[model samples]
Target: MIGRRGFLKFFGSSIVGLMTLGGYAFGYEPVVRLSIARYQLTPPGWTPGLKLRIVALADFHACTPWMTADRIASICARANDLGGDIIVLLGDYTSGTDFVTGHVDHRVWAAELAALKAPLGVHAIVGNHDWWHDATAQKRGAGPTFSHKALADVGIPVYSNRSARLEKDGYGFWLAGVEDQLALRRSVRWKRQFTTGLDDLSGTLAQVNDVAPVILLAHEPDIFPTVPSRVSLTLSGHTHGGQVRVFGWSPYLPSRYGDRYVYGHIVEENRHIIVSGGLGCSVAPVRVGVPPEIVVIDLG
Candidate 1:
């Protein structure tokens, strides 16, 4: 029923709009706007005058076009410049998924990450992707992945359901790393075989004193509830801030609790959780309202 001129106008406008959006998603949004999220925390056993800075880098899905080894090296350089007391690396180092796969020298990537310097040292934990791809390759009866070994070679201990005590200038606290929850879920399978893994929360906490202020590192924010109130703060990633938030909502959030723990700082009673938007994309390589970021938590 439409006239020729009107139909042409409408079609042309639609094409133009799609092109613009495509450009932003595929180009500008993916490359630009590396954000730094800062939070101030006053946990249980804090001396009023002393301040500690912890920088968290999460979901570095390396080897993608937008997230190259050079790009990761640059990110480490930027993080080093921040002068954080401790640097925490949340997982997802490789880009092996149904939608996309990337290959890079694990040694090279590890070397770049090894360059990062912090007083309290750099610590890390694995993510679901690491489990899915067997980044440690413990599934095939093979040993840990080259990437994991490389990280260890650089003195960055990647904890799995373990606790490490860190002290500086007579002030001390516990840093606990919980294995990825999805690592144990039977649904996370490959080639018709279940990737039976383990994430013992109680085992990780058992080494720590109940009254000691603890900072937990977990890849998925859903574990926030399982964490006892004795733990002061928890840092996490894996949702990618919903990856493509439109008007503060996303259709494809990779979370078990929907959008509840999508991104940013979340507070519950005496506990706190900071979920980073993370450094790379999955499935489709694009971002809308959500931007990749490095989170800095300052505790006093």
Candidate 2:
């Protein structure tokens, strides 16, 4: 229905638009933008009149030209300024993608994270990449990954299938962290009996002997469906908002449930989970629509 000139004009415009989008995804969002995402919710079993501020940093995938030690230190400084009641690190500290020119040393990143300050203290959990990158753990088909050791050496408690008790004012609650849900790979040499995860959700929850409500920290959100109502809230990060979401949906979802457990606050059956978009890239170092975020959750 158009002439030659009109068709040429439309084609030129379309090419320019695609180029702009590609530039933003590859250069701008991943490299330059760091956002803060906040949520306020009162979990089902949360104590009345008790407010908690949780600042979370996740999926740093520390590598050159993206998440450098200086950048991590800067992020930590900003988190410290937030004065959060508790600070949590939701793992994947090692490089997620091999597109880096250099890998940031574990000690260097750990030291930068050491600067984080919180009244209830800083807590950490390991992600799939953390386990995958550990040569010793992968070879042996067991844990105590380098990521765990690094965080522990820096005074941050890396909760691998464990629970810790904490309080604010007169209110008390429990914090539990499970091991990575996708820790080991099923390989021929590894034997057919190799397990998928290092996680022991039941064992971790069994450690909670008291009546305090529990807040569970997981690096991946795929465990939400099975999370018991006994847990007041569950916090997670790892999907990175599907890394390159478009129009609130990602064509490439990393989880088994696809976009269902991809990102943001999801409430089901009176239970709650806050899945952070996180601060780094996975698979590849490109982002569109979903920018790197530092998640701040206000809970009661």
Estimated TM-score for each candidate = 0.90, 0.95
lDDT of the structure predicted as candidate 1:
0.81
lDDT of 2 by residue, 162-207 (tens): 9998999898899999999999976676663664988899999999
Report the C-alpha lDDT of model 1 over 1-300, residue by residue, as the tens digit.
999999999999999999999888867776666888889879765555657899999988776576778889888989998879999999888773344445656677778889899998999998877666653364453335555676898778998889988886777789999877777334433343554445678999999964557889999898888888778888999999998998888999887689889998888776788999998887778888887788888998
Instruction: List residue ranges in candidate 1 displaced over 4 A.
Output: 1-3, 44-47, 96-102, 135-143, 184-197
lDDT of 2 at 162: 97
Whole-model lDDT values for every prediction? 0.81, 0.90
- Which pairs clash inside model 2? none
Query: Roughly what TM-score does model 2 have, to 2 decimal places?
Result: 0.95
